[model samples]
Target chain A: MIEGAVWRKWVFFYIPLAAFVFLLLFPFYWMIITAVRPDAELYRPWNAPNYAPFWTANPTLEHIRYLLEETLFSTWMLNTMIIALVSTLISLVCGVFAGYALARLNFPFAGGLGTGIFVTYLVPQTLLFIPLSDIVRNFRLGDTPWALILTYPTFLIPFCTWLMMGYFKAIPKELEECARIDGASRFKAMLYIILPIAVPGILSAGIFAFTLSWNEFIYALVFLSSPEQKTVPVGVTSELIRGDVFFWGPLMAGALLGSIPVALVYSFFVEHYVAGLTGSVKG
Target chain B: MAQVVIRNLNKKFDEVHAVKDVNLDIRDKEFMVFVGPSGCGKTTTLRMIAGLESVTSGQILIGERVVNDLPPMDRDIAMVFQNYALYPHMSVYDNMAFGLKMRKFDREEIRRRVHEAADILGIRDYLHRKPRQLSGGQRQRVALGRAIVRHPQVFLFDEPLSNLDAKLRVQMRVELKKLHERLGTTAVYVTHDQVEAMTLGDRVVVMRDGVVQQVGEPLELYNRPANLFVAGFLGSPAMNFSRVRVAAANGGLRIENEGLRLAVPPPLAGRVGRYVGRELTFGIRPEDLRIATEADPRDLSFEAVVEVVERLGSETLLDLSVGADTMVAAVEPDAPARVRGRLRLAVNPERMHFFDPATETAV
Candidate 1:
């Protein structure tokens, strides 16, 4: 691949690839090691005689046990799951409809409206959350899962809509036209033909929306106050550390566990996600 | 079966007038083909008939009912697109049965019709396989199977065989003819291939720039094209034309150019008499020219040097230079003609065509 000599292959290709992989995986390795390290080894001084920061001589599950038993980690996991699933569903339905209309309908200003939706997705959540916090308070939804459930869709819908629109456009319009000629109405054609063809797109969008809401911190921190209502990212950080002190063991353990579901979702639908991104419909 | 009649059909896409004031009467059970170059409104007319496109101004009648306002589903018709448009996710059986299922047909009836159509198209072995699993020819058959299962009163095909390989295209064209004969359905097909138009159509409509140039039975249009476009578009080698001035010689009208001078045949002499002393286009197909023999009259013969000789197995084509004009002649393969050598060529007077240069219309 590097063209000629073995040294050239190592220098130009394999060495760079190895360095990139090491850089990417280093943080995950640190998190896993910290989550399993005993308290004695974790707090060891850097210059101490037997100190090894990268490896541990005695690995234990005490941090994970403490995270599970001492704090409301499981409650945060459940809350994140519910909020993410509901918001993703809400976003997906609206997104699929908006995407279909924008991509296929002949209405005026469809192009402008599509651009308008994409512009909404570009609005930074840091500023958007300020106004959203006001709305959440006015509706008396603070300190509850509904606050994030409703607000997540503001960004997620636009993301899903733009992605689904591109996917819907990639499918041949003749598939729908032939269906209509074959005695299916426009609605039926979309239901039986277009929707089935767009499953990969919908799955990719759903997974993305789910991951975004699951790891969201800004809105979760601003809106939810109760220990029971906080999602994983917010609760783990807020509960594990006090003003000037840090709980490294339980904090890393909570974070490591918090990311598992999202990782599983990605791995389960990786094939469809790639296919959706490439937008191929073979006939 | 039902007759499809279009009256003053037109389509406008913003500033482009895609189809203009087209009227045609397609009789019942007739395989009518709309043939033309790209953007010539042949597909547009077919789409209007299928109710896929809105008519800018006109009426489309199928079976005595005006289908101008009807959606494609309400009109009883089936279409096979050039790309096959087979549902990639559906199996052959489900794809064929989808239309029947949509119309709420009973399960048994749908199954029976799907099987029968598959049997006709010989795709019975692929009933459980998705469209992507089939070859191009097999996919084409499945597309045809999908249409026939519906048993619609009319069928519309938009260059359905153009996507196949050349050998497969010819094979499918013959099968399509046999299929139409077996079904006896009134069909409207669209294509740009002249050979496909000639071989497959009971009638052919040649169009250009969104206007119908000529429409008749295939051979009829070939023998009697109304204009220069139709004459040139319908034939493979294309009719050759040379601008020749008419002159009076010995009480008869003669046509002469830089290298050719011949008396007008008696059958066309009356039309040539008025154009004397004016320029007109002399037309002849390649097959209408041959090497001159002793029996041929000297007046109808001309001397030329062969510039190129193409030896096709069945016949040979010679590109000849006659003074300033060049012409191609399809001659017997064994004809003793050599490149750069002189040969006397004669024109078949009966097949000689003349056109008014001003209007480019056949006289």
Candidate 2:
């Protein structure tokens, strides 16, 4: 009886937790189910049972095979990875230095500069897409990943810099002073002391920049005209829609595959991601 | 080890002079302390000597070299800050080895010095543990160890013990004195605590309002303060002061106040004669005022109403008021005294201090 009460206590606490867990897992579960279901079962009414019993039914790999063979899904995935990785690297390099400067150095108009950079982040990408599209068209870089790479950094750099600046500011100035007094040059101090301590924050900001580049749809949709040059979001949406009819199986399959890598990256750096978000918001 | 000399050191923040015309000479292998209240520029003066703050005008010399234009690292001074300033990310070993590594010392040499400092600080076992895992006292030891490993020409302490609890502060104070004795390195310490100044320093310099008030051996400053500020700032329970007028009586000097009058010692008669009939302030320490007994004459006595009696174990502090003036008297804990009762207290004439009111200068 006593053991049951103790078990009940745990169950009481975990019930809502389990419900939230189920709530989060439900959409992914449904997507996997819909992707594997035959076309006959997929069109059934809402009240009908659309899922096959896992033990009795034989699962098929047709959707995965079709996604690979019928469309430029692999090419789109490769292009997205390259664009995201390059953009993240660029943002990290620019953000770290700008963050360090905003956090530590005092220059003429430094406060104004910090506020100006943060305000640039506040301007929505939706508002600037028209003007940026004109610039990309003027440069004749349309239908190329180079356009996305160049345009994405404009959004990534400001927000990433703002995140890293807040993170760097939380570090004690005395630590750097101690390094300086210990015979380190200013550059060496930043490399040895500040950078090591700021790793988590930097990683968090990098993940954010990578995810933003990967998930961006509107700009990718409007800018890239060639099917082969399209990123994951644009390629999936444009190729999956034929004419008022959706190819639910392969589309959902590609979407699920496309989001997995990013989800895994986020899960790996969840602690730092949360810290970065709160840190940037607080600042 | 090297002597640190500050000549006409002045620092200005806008129109406010934080440290003004402050000239200080700290000898090699000597432990000197700067003692003052807040905003008195003791810490500012120390920072200027460390090259952490710029001297608006004047020169700082470590040994024979002018360090006014030098950075802190080139100045060869290690400072133990009040907050310990240990690297939160680094373990104790790394914190101590950081300075040596930055100087491009050999790896083996760095390891030897870090271990030696850790052993001296009794933090060897905890070298791999981060700072947050250590207690306050342990962290303080790590800070001291970091400075000790550098073996710099001068060690500067900016009220290093101020952050510790009272009990740990006393313990650290004794350990610091022992460390100073063992090393015999030139050290400049800053503190607002007079007791810390008296106990730790070979020579104490008291400052006020960005000016050097008095500089001398602790006992010299205690026994013979330079002025009213020094007298009031040095002692606990503080010295009592009352305005009085000096008048000549039978070839001697009589110090008269509203409640009482007493004869000045003959040696001070000449000094008092110049200020005769002029209003002056008389100062006396709490310990110097004793209860009148058969051993002391009644002529130097005054009546005081005892407002409160604090019965500390070894000694008693009596709070007494005479007319509009209040004074504290320290006596044997067993002394017979009751609150709300009148007591006769005798002032030792030879121990009394007289100051010129207008200049606040000793007379």
Candidate 3:
């Protein structure tokens, strides 16, 4: 608590908190306002006397309608959704098994293998997309949803594996041992006992993988071609802007709609996500 | 018929030899306890019996079959960890029923066994609660219920009650003893608390480092400790030791140091005959010493100056300086003792212990 004076509390606590909140939310607020603003008002000069940039007297649904009907925005939505869900499922299944093996099994070079997986996650996507695009071409997966669905796990699996490994390590080893002694085989013990306790860790990993693939740009832009095969991020940018002209209203509308599903996913699992990250086991 | 026999059991963790060659025959339905300090191999031995730790070179016989190569699941045993190891995600009923469920018991039988075990542990009211929702003592009971519901051949407990508070530990200790008596299952319990070992075990095994020092009934080990380490480790305010040279006097042997002279008791005279004129250790318990009265024999009495007085309601402890050595005496609480005062203390001849200083073994 800021002590002694009311003004001190305002200066040290309230003002800084307010500034951070404003800085974080201002872009979303601008997106919402611009999505509803008229084109005439959006294109007006900054020094124009009658310019009212922050608010619109007549809010419109024209941009949303145009985004839905005039372009392949709906197709991109379906494409991104299918790609993100399938890759997240594939990555999660691989990560759960790999993480469990790394955390519990005592094979030789286990520590080195874990470090190698982490190193793969650390490789920048900008450079990795070069070789990955070649693989995509060789597999004859270009201009298709299968291209992004199969390639996204290259990065997502490593990421999910490391996250799940740390979470699995936090659980007590005795839980599995006790289960084994209770007459369950080693595999059954892990499936029934260890995996149930690891629900939060699995959920957090799934959410993170889903968001990463949903918002990915470099690989999605490179491997996928044709307007119909694009995802939200690439589709919004490439289609909304014409040569030397930006469709400010419709572009903001696309941005607003594009972020809603990811936002909803985060808000729904926020409690479990925090618990998973902190790695607290009650017993 | 569940007799656990360990023959030449040993364990080595890379460069560290954790449990040396050990052999034990735990009788059917016996509550056997292993007591020692940290890293003393007590827990390691219990884990070996539980099949959680692989033996280096040994044979373990559960009933009749050798279990050295068997995995824990096939060993027909249940273990309770120090932290309870209760499944946090499961309800108390599910936690108790889990082992039986894994063995593919029918639904009605699983429910009946879980309820029966919960009823025995007095946890029936908590049947639907999750493990995290219960208190520490309740979690401990749930862990016990989990083990008992399985009705395994052997039950292994690794310091199960050490996590509870003092009062709860005592209460749970009594409940555990009662539970053992009712179930009549062979149990191998590991603990560092000597009080728990004495109060719970039908026979106790005392270990140090990685070696088994002594295994006998509680008072038997207390009265006749195999060596100096067992003597000191088994008692509270432990047994006192004073180094003295054995001297020949009056056609018999006497052990004497700077401030005192004491004759070797009749039974131990022959044992001390060869150690005459050589230094040895004299051992006595604090409860064996008392303020000497006129009826006490002069040959068994010595002088000590009181340094501190501690009144513990039931007894008074006097920290005394006897010549160059310090000792503590537990006397009646009403004994009028004060600091800087001199008192004549009489030793019980039969209770005096003599040990060879070099070997630290009983003479």
Candidate 4:
């Protein structure tokens, strides 16, 4: 954006930007190249004559075909989609109401309650999973999607609540008050006026919750032991590697396919997601 | 249209008392304004009447019903907020029609009222557009349109025009008067701007620190303010104050201070004679001070050194040092005055105000 000569633009803007883009995209590029490259090149020694790690001459769909046919990739995809979606929905519903109450309602200990909710989010899945695993077993939800679906919200709700609390706070209180004076009850006012204005905020919360649950790992790893019940992050890593012999091509294929849905979700709600982060509520 | 009455209103927000024992009977079709500085509880009082804020312990009656426990929707009122608060998601038409829609007033009736309000506010062309697309003034009109479309029994404006620029504010002020005249709905407006309160309200309530200082017509409050705060709060350049002692000198009562001494007018001389030797606060408006001319009486004039001369086109304001106190005098624009100049300024004897120093109340 700096207006100047070519070298100034290069020094301040373009070169740094190009370097950043290259660095960020390198992993994805490597993933695609490894997934498509022939297994001979993938497993070839580095000292071989035609060893070109970054480039491949004969690209094939064998890894993708093997991932779909030989492994439970499709079932994992379905499991992840359902678990992520259901948890995101539960988190969003709880988050929106909890956020609105924390932001707008004048109740005793509301401030302390909001802080308490945030502190729960910070308990770290690494440590909390020990206690949660006990809780998961007590109900015997292991090896089923129910284990992940019910547990994902334990973390996702807090995250969505905090994000949505800040977002709801940024909205002007007068919108709801004006709606009330305009002859709508408090609930109606929220539905007709405040919530409509908070659409961007809610979407951003939902998108974040969706993305967080989609990319989640620990809970998916601990629970749901069945091959058909496993989520993508758990299924891809567990099934692809066998006793130190890595299935690099199919693993990369699993990663690439697993990330596509998240990418699509982001692209679809990109505008709202950005607006929600920047806190642009036009009066 | 129904009158709104607030009786024995008191509100305590935990440790802070936001509104004190307040009483006002806003008449049917009356435009009542509550004007004060921030934290003076004018908006709190308005919100209490709007049923947005609960009364800590009091009664608010909109028409004949005591609405202390009624919800805002049940209060049958409309309010215009300072930020406009137009639903950003809805089109202008939908924004205006939302109340009607919530009431289950069918499609055609909602359309009729929305269009009628849009026509009145001159916002028909932007009916399909969103709030963010409109200018500030247009958005203000849309907010007004939204309120008018509801046709509520009462209208509450919580500093609605404060967000507007100066020119647009003046324009809107006039339009609000015209709108009120057209609708004749009871209104309760709150603002920190004294000029707005003076121009717009049929009756203005001046408050300070959660207490109602005075309530009267705008000119009544301007001419005969109840206390020191009201006299100082209403005027443009503010009234000047000087601590002076009243004493019997020669034959009659005279007001004497470090910088000036002037005889009391005969009408107030008997009243002034009672507080002979005690010190009290003296107040005189800047506009009542003039450049002393040849015909000016000697005892009613004083000489001072002018510090700064500000010619504001219509009037000239001189910041002057009198004894140990700084005083501002608003004189005629054509007056020959300069900084560092020794100038004689005359005071209108009839316009002088006196208040007890301890009570700070007019004597």
Candidate 5:
């Protein structure tokens, strides 16, 4: 009787996890099926006799070839890489110093400053876009990748700084003090001691910053006016919807290709990424 | 080896005075331990000397140079924290060599010093392991090795062994004393443990409420505490104090308590003469009280019911009540005593201490 009850408990525990796995993977499976199906089978009725099987023989690579060959997909990918890399780099440099200062330094209004940084992050980017557009126009950087790199840090820095603050706080204060007494200057101690120890957190923050820049859409759509300077989100959107007509095949193909870089980057830093995200979410 | 001189040092945090107008001189190559209860500013004092904490006033001198304004990097000192504070990411070798590298020493010199320190700390074999990979004792040794490699003029240990188990703490206490003797470096260690201070320090500074109560050799502090605080703080089973009054009695000063009275020592009779009718705090160490049998004349005696008798293998501790006041007495483990028994105990009159009732100062 005890064995039967234990087996029932195990079954109850695994059922939801199994169901969630199937739900998560089903969409990806459908997307792949849609991407490879012949054009005639794209929208067949559910009750039709010609509905494709799981292992259909009519699979085609036409959409993938079309996305790669006819459009400026490669250029958009390159532009996205440049903007994300530059933004992530800038955010890390400014955010890490600000985070360390907020965590360790004592000043008249240090706590207020930390709270202010977090408040800045809470101000949605949608609300700042109008004022930011005028600033970008004034700087004469409207149609360049530099515009995105410069604008992204506004959102990225605050959140990154907040995340880094939590990471720094988790570290023992004694470690830094020991380093200081061991002939390390404040900067040297942070670099040699604090920074090395905070690598996982920093990497996690960097991955978040990179992914944010790569996947960002609203700002990129409103900011970039030229095709050559557009990021993946804006470029894909503009190309997929010319006038009122939709191009589902190439759109899905572009999206699949566009998301690959971010997916690869996340996988590379999955450990730090999880840690960093959890730290930020809790904050 | 260098002497540390802290003159009129004061540290204030906003409105609270963390350390107030402290003045102390630690001799060259002395193993000085600052011991106190929590929030007694022992750590604050040590940090101020290490240049990790800034002084609000006065000066600190290492050797002959005033180092009040110097940064920690320029002060030339090393500290071992209570938690060991080993860099979790670095190997033991790198942790030990870090200070040398930071000072821009030659790579060969750094390697040589690290290996030498590691050898002395018995961590030569664990040099490749990170801090988390080593046991608590090994990590503690690595922390000491890190300080040793720096070869600083002074070493500051901020409760370095407080995290160790009881047996390990005793072992490390002996090792630390031997290490100090071998290196002969000026070291300022901070701890709340009186046993650690007594066993390790050449001189112990007993502190309370951000002030130094007494500073003397371990035995001197134990035998002759400067104040009630020092006397109470130094002993393990702390000295018991009871309200007593001095009375004029036939050619000697009579110390009278609620249920006991004894003649004052000859040396203290004249000093305590002025307080003949005044109430004072009488202190007696637990170890000084013993079972009184027919073989000895009881100078000061008390008959009390044993409330609790703890047999600790080597020593037996008895908690007894006399006239509503409870006191603990330590006797031989094999002594024939049991709970609820009426026992006769003798307090040695010469070992008794008297303090001013209001001022709490030793009379």
Candidate 6:
């Protein structure tokens, strides 16, 4: 809130915030409106005597029904869910260990190695997919769920490892030392003390990995080919949109439905996510 | 219980020598305190004894067994950290039991030990609550309970009472001393406060710059300090020092400075006669000086102007200026003294200390 007159507050804070929120949310509103609006109203010309772009006079669930019945949207959802979960789990295990080692252990080249791993994440996926596709073919894993599930971790692990490394460093070193002196092996101390205190960090890392794998398109497109095995992002765009004709209602319908799971996850762990970002451990 | 022995202990971090060659034989069931300013390597030495920190060279022994190669888990020690380091997420009961659980104690024994430690700490009612829910004093009890439940051979404390308020610190300091007596564990405590060192330690080791300056009973260190640093470090307002030259005059050794002159007592005549014509640091605690009467010997008295008067209920501390030097004297609260008032103060010749100006070693 800007302190001063009401108009000053509006000019400095509230009005700009309103414009920003409207700009960010208009696309989502458009998606929902297009998904439920009747095709008759949706295709109405802009020059019509009565034209309203933001709202529809009549709304129906026909596009959702078409999305479920006519296409393999349900199968895409299932495939995406399995891939994202398995990849998140795989990344988390590897990330937690790598992050702990980089954060706690005294080893040669640890600093350089951490930076090197993060550098791999900076390489654009657009360029890496070409080589990755060749490997997927070499392993004969193309056109299967394994194609994306295993490939998703290539980017996810580095991202998760970096996030967890910073989180583990914020914790006081005395906690582990005290546990060790109390007759716990180093491994047991980490399991009982460090890992439990790091729940927020782990949860946030898991959520971020889930979202990244869920929205990932290039690797999904490059690897899977079968319609039923395809992920949500790929199947929705490639199968529904034919050569030159865009299925506006069903397209918007798929977009809106495809993003719900990520939103639900974010809201579910919103409190822990903020804690992880702030790295506040009260003692 | 076990005695800890460190021989030629040294620790080096990159280019910095954090702990130098040090040797200490901490007796079994003895409450030994290591007191020093920050970066004096007291905590580092304690950590080495606990095996949390690896020794760069030399050896550490718990009992007769050398623990130089053992990990912290095998060292049989428990530590209370400066911040308490309570496990923030667990209930007080679970935090206290974590050590027993890690050591594979039976469930019934773990509960019994936890309850006993909690009873001693007076935190039995708060055992089910989390550390964050408790107040600072309760949280401190939880930290202590966690350490006591282990029943290790030694207890290591690293400035554990420093985080508490002044009043709470004094209260906890007494509780800690009683706890040590009942537990009868050989404990190594570290603190920067001289008062804490004086009250709690059976024997205190004063360290400075990674080296031991003096180690003795608290009163011994106070009454008879080994060096300049120990003399000034162990007192409340600190021992005052003035550079003075020894002169052979009037058939006696006269200690003369910018402020005044006094004859060396016969007990130190042999030591004082050799330092004639050489400058030495003369030290006198504030409590050893008093407002002088006209009948007091002129040789032991000096005319001074009171600069500031600190009326501490039990005593009045007068900051005085003599010639070009400033000195502080603790006098009776009823003494008629005011700022800028000229007065004659008498020095206690028997209590005076002399140190070499170059080496700073007691003469």
TM-score of chain B of 1: 0.98
Best by DockQ: 1
Cα lDDT tens digits for candidate 4, B157-205: 9899999999999999999999999999999999999999999999999
What i-RMS does every model get? 0.6, 4.8, 0.7, 1.1, 5.2, 0.9
By TM-score, the candidates rank as: 1, 3, 6, 4, 5, 2
| DockQ of candidate model 5 | 0.53
Provide TM-scores for the models. 0.98, 0.91, 0.98, 0.97, 0.96, 0.97
Candidates' C-alpha lDDT = 0.94, 0.88, 0.92, 0.91, 0.87, 0.92
For model 4, the TM-score of its B chain against the native B chain is 0.98
DockQ values of all predictions = 0.91, 0.36, 0.88, 0.81, 0.53, 0.85
Instruction: Give the per-residue lDDT digits (tens) of candidate 2, residues B1-363.
Output: 999998898999878999988888999999999999999999999888877778899999998999999988898989898878788778889999999998999999999999998888899999999988999999999999999999999999999999899999999999999999999889999999999999999999999989998889999999888899999999999999988888888877888876767788888788878989888888999998888886766557788899999999889999999767899999888999999998889997778888888988898
Between candidates 3 and 4, name the one with more favorable TM-score. 3
lDDT for residue A115 in candidate 5, whole number 0-100: 96
What lDDT does model 1 reach?
Answer: 0.94
Give candidate 1 regions above 4 Å deviation: A1-4
Which model scores highest in lDDT? 1
* Local error of candidate 1 at residue B302 (angstroms): 2.1
Indicate the DockQ of the complex predicted as candidate 2: 0.36
Which 10 consecutive residues of model 1 chain B have the lowest summed lDDT?
B232-241
Clashing pairs in 3: none
Instruction: For candidate 1, give the docking quality class from DockQ.
Output: high
Worst 10-residue lDDT window for candidate 6 chain A reads A274-283
Model 5 ranges with Cα > 4 A deviation: A1-11, A45-47, A52-57, A275-283, B295-299
lDDT, candidate 5, A58-100, per-residue tens: 8888888887788888889999999999999999999999999
Task: Please say which candidate is ahead in DockQ: 1 or 5.
Answer: 1
| Lowest summed lDDT window (length 10), candidate 5 chain B | B294-303
* Candidate 4 vs. true structure, TM-score: 0.97
- Residue pairs in clash, model 5: none
